[model samples]
Target: MSAPANAAVPQAEQSLRDTVLSRGYLRLLLLCVLLGVPIALACFFFVGLQHLLQHWVWESAPEALGYAGPPWWWPLPALVLAGLILAPIVTRVPGSGGHLPVNGLGGAPVGPKELPGTVLAALATLPLGVVLGPEAPLLAIGSGLALLAVRRSAAADAKARAVVATAGSTAAISTILGGPIAAAVLLIEGAGLGGARLVALLLPCLLASAAGALVFTGFGDWTGLETGALALGELPSAAGPDVGDFLWGLPVAALIAVLVTLGRELGRSTVGFTRRGSKAARTVACATAVGVCITAYALITGRSPAEAALSGQATLAELAADPHAWSVGALVALVACKGLAWAVSLGSLRGGPIFPAVLLGTATATAFSGLPGFGTAPALGLGIAAAASATTGLPLASAVLAALLLGGDAAEQMPLIVAASVVAFIVGQLVRRQRPEGATDTAGAAGAAR
Candidate 1:
């Protein structure tokens, strides 16, 4: 006489409806709407400042020194300075510079006390070319700022605080993901929302994101400040997937998954290494090693070290706009150098992992564009989807993210993108599961460092 699964649906629906109608939820909805604007504004300023500082360090300073761009040795000093600044924050700061990127963006919401450390760590390192993204720090900042709005008495209600924090996070993250839809899908898939709880949380998040998007749109127009969001502008034309594209995309996606998994393994090893010695010294050593990797890429390819040093947003855009700019051999070197820097940064630095992984995927896929059936556009889309799915372990979100990045051409390439995402997701899971039991536990070890 157990209740049927179908029977639970109505009860869940009724509970969701009741919850939505409740006064507390109504208040929360209002709070989310109100909070979204400010949260997005804060994120806007944060991202804007980070970009400005980055431009100064990499562009202005080098130009002042009469170089076309940063010299090959430029990253060494910049990264050393970054390490010196970041070491103290990671060791002494309350949040340990926020969670290590190897943990894949799942953790408790940050509180106000940890906000300074998180922001300082990102500003200090990311602008100095740490090969990490700003998403995690933005997430931490949003959640912390939101929690700060709660009354001391209300703080005891963990559930309400979490919801508000999530809403704030969605709003802040929405600014960077171009808009709320991809951000919402990302959080939904990453958090595994379902059932009544899903319905309950979805409303607040959606409201916050929508409101935040509106504010960001208006503010950018008014202030004329660049948000430096992750988006591609001029992509090469693409057509619908033919049988050949699908056939070739499968193994390509799997290969990307394997490559990304290897990067994560390297991150685990870094976590283990950082744990053994004086944490501060070890962190600086990892940072300097990342600098060496960037220097190696610049020396070998005769390109700017910036290409291999920071989060790969600009390089990705450049690659999408003109894949021909990079020779296959150069792309391979970019992959090798940037991939190692990214892997080390993942366990020792404070930033998001998804951006560089997407770049890595794109580089790898673009190298294979000359394959029998693979066109450059299809290769680009497949690489983006596969890398994103593998790195984040959220196939549906990765598909949406890839489609968003691919822009109008994505409509034609959706099928290929979806297939690649699914393939990469499955392959990534298999790779992780296949790791030996004695292997360094990337998530656990990285989490401990945090």
Candidate 2:
């Protein structure tokens, strides 16, 4: 009787395991399809929107507000009004107007109900030159909407909810990255997912990315904007790293790591300071200061003020394409100016730091490209990857992003980028580790006191 009872117990446990696995796998597949398609589509839509806006909306809107136009000071009043409105929205809204971009990049996820406010807030804030990127809001809004859709149609299970939310977030910025693969990898690695679950999660992300590419391609076609090419023209050939190049890169990366750490600290301190002040006062003051800095940079460097104020992608691309256009002094100035501007933006505004960081890194590399053994393109590529990795602590994502941006040269430059990133990561980790535990406790207490 004992032996028979034991046999039945094992059988019952096996049956339960089978049921769970069966359901889990099935739910996983469903999540992949639902989230993947929407994310890809959203990415597609965003790309299309950007293209249209660049070519048509902004171009067609009056020259005053267009890219070629002078900086629109008239928008300042509206922006201030928006900030006033946003303060209340942020205070009243659940999840503080949805998950912040910084939090999302740091691996936080958002739910369905928060999508609308996230999108609206980001669109309003970013275009006003609030010194942020759309990436974070993109993730929050995308995931939130996806979750809302799924919950309405399907029964809510914890696993299912997580899977769908993840998928939505993945879909949101699938195309902002060169491809869906990088975004998927970022989400998977950042989340620390593993085993069969990783495989299951990747399927939906990949599918969504592919869908996003297609959607973006279609929209580009309709809008007459160039789209769908992942590679930037022909891949530039990479020059092998000489011994001196490696040595120089190590020090450059270390210096950059320190600068990045400082920038982060500055941003945190500024944010803390601003939080103690009136929101309206802080926002206006920060924006005015950013505008003054941008105007000064442009006046001193003979570049457009807008160049200093925007995401700096276009400027980075130009610098990468022609390193000699700007002198080393100019590049260094831009880096300093951009870094300070970015830090300021983080204090009182909302946006993603990713693009600005990449811009600064690429600019730094370009500035130093004339040194022996370091050419323009390779330096730009390596620096961008290393700086991004150091700040974000997403080494793989940074490597892949830099590689994608570098096109065919990716294989050749991958080794150096990886090496530099390792050094930068070590530097970052070391600095983080060295911070006193009590300092964090004190900071937390201070924040609480406010």
Candidate 3:
């Protein structure tokens, strides 16, 4: 009986392998490679434009206006304008200007009809200092374009379309997050899939992401344009973590998880608020509130509002390169102000939630680095992994993302990073379980509006 059972298992495995390696699946794989090119190009231009607009708003405009940097009052008007611009798109356009950041990045792919709204909403808000990142919009664009290309084909069923959409989205975000591996890891962990089904989805995602990375790199080199990849330029040097680092890091990671989860709760509350009244008015109000937070950070810390505004990628790089440049008070203010802005933006704005969450964690960890056992590098890695894990609810992806960000230092830090991510993920789950039942209803209602 045991021998017979083992024989049946091999038969089943062979059947699964045969299905995946069939001619149709092979065709689909080839299509993913072709699909990756255009998707990558679209994302490249999309991110480039957003970066240009951001530079103008925060840098060029300030210089053009004869100010050394943007004054404290700058974000107020800029964010108001962003709100005004984004209001109509979110209220009137289809797809409600893409999925709310609070929803995480697991929603249905944006179709062709919804792409314009996603682009408009992101352009209107993100460049103007809405505390969000481009990953959401890029995901939308990639999926929409992929669907648009294949929508007329009778052969493309729902499952095929879904696979292609996943591939396209991964391709779209590949460069931004480092590469296809990180993007694929995000999908794999976030999807909660297993076995043959997971493998089926994984193949196209990897192929598309590889092609996309190639296009992104080629175009960036050819055109001398920036791809706006997430990177850490310089990090404080540190050897492998000592026992003390782990002792302090474990608690700090938990604290970071709590804070990130708290931000998500705040986002859920904001979602309820936005849905209660006129969405347009409330959206503008929320944008302005984010602006107010950015302004407050600048005023309180006497630092550039740019540090608190936009996606935190630039600030993240700066902080990583030179952690000591910022005082403890300044780091605290960043966590408070940018964290609030990030939470609000998560509910009411059109963007991704992960980037700012990572920054919050990094800031928090850097602030606590003075503790007896904690070194800046270990804390930085731990903070990144913990915050990302908490925000995305994907410990493996968070760990991988932190490792990628850590670059050469990643080898030494991987163990601590992985532990931190797991701790954060567990804590985040507990926090979600603790949320009031009513919050789920509010989230559903908010989801319905989008």
Best by lDDT: 3
What is the overall TM-score of model 1 with all chains considered together? 0.86
**What are the per-residue Cα lDDT tens digits for candidate 1 across 327-352?**
99889999999999999998888898
Question: What's the lDDT for residue 241 in model 2?
Answer: 56
Query: Which tens-of-lDDT digit does each residue in 349-396 have in candidate 2?
Result: 665677777787777766776888776666876788777776676666
**In model 3, how large is the Cα lDDT of residue 6?**
88
TM-score of 2: 0.76
TM-scores of the candidates are 0.86, 0.76, 0.87
lDDT of 2 at 369: 69
Error of 2 at 209 (Å): 29
lDDT per model, in order? 0.83, 0.63, 0.85
Ranking by TM-score: 3, 1, 2
| Comparing 1 and 3 on lDDT, the stronger one | 3
lDDT order of candidates, top first:
3, 1, 2
Task: Compare the candidates by TM-score and give the number of the best one.
Answer: 3
Instruction: Flag regions of model 1 displaced more than 4 Å.
Output: 1-9, 151-156, 194-237, 433-450
